[model samples]
Each structure stands twice: as C-alpha cells, then as structure tokens.
Target: MVYALTTRITLSTYESFFRIVRQILPLNYNQLTIITDYERGLMNAVRIVFPQTKLQGCWFHFCQSVIRYCKRSMNSLFQLFQTSVEAATVLRMVLALPHLPAESQINCNFTMLDGFQIIVDYVNQQPVIRERLQAFLFGYIQDFWFRQITAENISVFGLEFLKNDINRLLLYKL
Candidate 1:
C-alpha cells in the first residue's frame, strides 16, 4: 500500500496512482476509510476515484498543522499559547474539538450561532487580550478547518469503538 514516487505530488499523479490501485486491489470501497494527512491533491484524488469510501484527516496532523499555522501567522498568539496557562488551555480546547460529538445539535435562535458558541462563550469570559486571541483562533478555525476540511472529517467522536472493533476483527482474521 506504499508508493515511492519520483514525480511531484499532484492531482494527476494521485489520480494515476489511485487508478492503478483500483485496477490491482479487490477492495470494498464502501467499507474503506482512508485516514490521511490534509493534502488537498491526494484527498481530491481519493474522492474522485473512490467516491463511496470515507475519508478522514489524521488528528495528529490536523493539530500539528493548526499549531504550525498559529506559529507562522500569529506568532504573538503562539507565544501566549506557550507561556500562558489560560492561553494554552484555550488552544488545547480548540485542538480537542475533533473529539466533540459530531451529531450534537445546539438550539440557537441567533442565525450566527452554532455549536462553537460554547467555545466563544468561554473566550468571552477571558480578558480583552485573550478575546483578541479567541478572535484569531475562531477565524482560523472557520476559514481553514471548517471551510477547507469538513467538521465530519475532522471529528473522531463515536468512531473509537468502531476502530477498536475493526482492530479486533483484523487480529482475529490474522
């Protein structure tokens, strides 16, 4: 299942690779869940080739990417994240978002409100400086995570048990 490619990783390259994989493997695409890092080209190719398969971004990669982004784009905030316990906690909460129940609904009368309101509410209670930090974090989450990668793909809630069961089944089969 590993490919050592000399060519640059691109949509065409991934598409060609996936096409060959489809030809070679007797895979049940419907039952397949591919967990990969957030690479748009590879993800898009997988979606194109195996539309029925579930695609999930690796949680570790997601966290690393977010932290790296914070460090690069908002260094002051990143510094605060490292030095301040409160700031660290908020960032940790943001990172833990993928563990939230994906199916939970928050009843809100306001058009702008959603499940993330809880995070906002917590941020609002913090000092004004922290509020600025919250704004940056929220904007980042909204623009990058929510827009580019879907919440469903990011969230791992309720999947741990299924993953465990799958692991058990694989062990038994082996």
Candidate 2:
C-alpha cells in the first residue's frame, strides 16, 4: 500500500511518485500486478518505472466508463439498455468480458476472443440494427476497449486472486 498527497497530476509527477515507490518497496516487478483506472499518465508512468510489472485497469472503472460513454454519446443505446431486456443482457455481457477466463481452461477453452465472438455473433443476428447501433457500439468497443486500453490491461484474465480482492474492495466501497 502506498499514499502520497500531490498537487499536480501529470506523467512526470507520477513517474517521480513511482520511483519513490520503487525505492521503498522490495517489489518483484515481474510478479507485481497493479490495478488502476484508465489514467494515461499514470499508466504510462508505471510502464516507464516498472517495465516488467503487470498493470491491470480497475474493472469497475471500465464498466463505469462504458456506461458513461453510452449515456453521453449514445443515448438511444443507453435507453435501450435500460428498457429492453435483450439490450440490457447485451450490455451486461459486454461488461462481463473482463470476468471471463483469460486463458484456455482444462475442460473448456473459453477465452476473451470467444467472449467477444459471442457478442459479435449476437450483434450480427440483426441486420438492420447491425448497420447502425451495432456498428457504433462495436466500433467503440474495438477502438477504446481493444485498441486503446487493451484487453490485457482491462481483463482479469490471469489474475483471479487480484480479481477477488478487487471485488471485495469494490463491495466494501459501495
């Protein structure tokens, strides 16, 4: 656990803070997994300071961001998510992507790709909606979730223990 009161939030400030953390903690960078929000500066700082450490984004934050985006930019989709059970289910499934198995299991080889494929398959079922809302939502998912934040950073995949702990923390906070 670490805490610092900072007046400025920037890449250099985060780098300095992380450097201090590195100096104080006897961290095994390879084994360390830091869960954070999708703050670009902080994430970049961590990468620069501890290149080998695994950086995971908070799942709650990811969900919150998606919902917020829908509310602000895609109000029609947001309304559908609230009123339509099928749309709600789809939204839930998208949010649950991070909770799905990151790697191949012994009995079932269900991976993130499989989860995404399921969504794509479902979306493709409706040709009319697929052209408009599906395109927008999938594009947002692909660009922001996949290309920008990345599946590796947002998904719980290989960090079950961390996921459980994070859930507990989230529950406690809520």
Candidate 3:
C-alpha cells in the first residue's frame, strides 16, 4: 500500500521519511532487507523506525565512490607503472571488496594484509596521496575491510580461482 505519494518535489528529509514510514503497516523485520546507497540520513531514520531490519548499502556505489576518489589523486601515487596496467590494478583492488564476503573467519584465512600493503605502498611514497588517502580511505573502508577479512569471518572470496587467473594473466602479459 502506498502510504503517501510525494506531495512536492524535494530532497528527502528525516522528518519526511519518518512520516511516510510510520503510515505504512507494521513490517516483518526478520525478512526486511533494505539495500541503499551510502545515505546516512535515510539509514538513521530506518534504524530508528525499524530497528530489526537488515539494512546494507549498495556495494557497487560504495566501491565506485571510492574508485572515483582514488582516480582523482592516482597520478601522484602510481608513477611506477604504465597507466593501463596501473589503472587496472588499482581498480581491481578496490572492486574486489564487494565480491568478498562480509566475514572470512570460518573459512580459510585468506586475509587482506597483502592488499593493504599494496594500497599503502602505492600511496606511501607520494605526499599528496598519502595525506588524502588517510583522510578519504582510512577511517571507513579500512576498518570495514579489516572486519570482513579478519581470521573469524567466513570467506566467500574465491582465493584459488583468483590466484589462477592472476597467474594466467601475468603469464600472458609477460
């Protein structure tokens, strides 16, 4: 049931969202999975209104946002490699997060310390990137990845397959 159509064209405010949600019938929180982009306002409202609902953000949007931010400052960091390979590698590492499971402790501990090193090494030598990376990438994404790739979470990331593919691709390139 449509509780309330948009009465006017405007950006959503917490009050507006709250009003719409309260009008809707009681929801089954057990089956409610809300997938959204990184909108804290809306997310906060949902948490307050429906505390038990599972609300996860869109992985693609999160990664794309990170990727765009990195691209703007990448030139300062990736002077060691040709642009083509460098861009591909940078994006591969960023995009790989979504494909990985939320936790990897139950499965093999294919942790992401290597990936962390790659990221740190790429940015460490460049002053501008190092500064911006600490600000943009460290707080949220770093903590999130560490939690997911820790020694206790179940792993859905395909380690063997990725290794084989990487080997084949490198062989072809070399």
Candidate 4:
C-alpha cells in the first residue's frame, strides 16, 4: 500500500517527526518514502539518517514554479490545456510530447489536469474570484475546443508538465 501526506512546517518539525518515527516504528531499509517541498536542509537531515528512503520534491510545489513563470493573463489558455488532457487520451497525448517547442511545451505542461487543481484551489478561496475564473476557463475552452464537462477536466491537476509549448493553441482544433 502507498500512502502520501502533505504537511506544512519548519525544517525542525520534519526533523522531529522523523526522529520520533525512527524510535517508535521499526523501520527497515528502503521502506519509507519522503515527498517533500524541497527544503534542502531538511532533505539533508533525512538523507543522513534514512539513507535508504527515497526522497523526492513534491510535484504540487513544482507546479507553482510553472505558474510563476506563466503569464497571468494567459490563465484561460491554461484551463483549456487542463480540461483537454485530464483523462486517459489527453494524458497519453501529454505523456507522448517530450521535445515540443518551448511555447507549446508550456501549454502542454501547465494545462495538465493535476496542475489546474492546485492553481484553482488557491484561486477559489478569494472573493468572487473562483466564479470569475470558472467563467474564464469555460469561455476559453468553448471558444476554442469543444465544450467539456468541468468536473472531469479539473481532476488531473497533479500531473507534471512534460511539454511546455502553449503557443500551439493556434494550430489544432483546440
């Protein structure tokens, strides 16, 4: 069985958690996995103590970097990317693209279903912003691609951007 948890805290908090877990749980080599937010110091500690555990930076946090680089005004394009590839067919399309041009790569990576959730979750808490965002995403998709169900499109916001070219929005039916 696989288990995952996202905890926000200082390095010391994670250090303490590991220390306590080590003492209480009879942990074995390569039995634990740590998906962290890439705090180098904390990762160092984990490495020193649990050498066999696999540690990876959280994908959710990595997406934030993409969002930061992406244009704020082009958010609607991001939504189309998300809705288009949230499922099996679209996901396969996303997985297949590795060497696409830079602009299209951004669209391909940023529009991932998994990514949209994290971005929109943060956006949704603001006053009236969620509705406005919903409107924008819907309008963008309808105007370009065929109309799609909102729920299905939004579910895969956790997948990483394999391709980054978003400018390709001009070339296809989407």
- RMSD of each candidate relative to the true structure: 6.8, 3.1, 8.8, 15.0
TM for candidate 3 is: 0.54
Please, what are the lDDT tens digits per residue for candidate 3 over residues 9-109?
Answer: 33356547655666765667677765544555656666676667765655445555555455455434233223445444555665565445444447634
Clashing pairs in 2: none
Q: What is the TM-score of each candidate against the true structure?
A: 0.79, 0.81, 0.54, 0.34
Give the winner by lDDT: 2
Pick by lDDT: 2 or 4, better one: 2
Instruction: Tell me the spans in candidate 2 whose CA falls farther than 4 Å from its real position.
Output: 102-108, 127-129, 162-174
Clashing residue pairs for model 1:
none
lDDT of 3: 0.51
Give candidate 3's total backbone clashes: 7
Instruction: Sort by lDDT, best first.
Output: 2, 1, 3, 4
Q: lDDT of model 1 at residue 75?
A: 45
* Candidate 3 Cα deviation (angstroms), residue 58: 0.3
Model 3 misplacement above 4 A: 1-12, 71-84, 111-174
Q: Candidate 3: minimum summed lDDT over ten consecutive residues — where?
A: 147-156
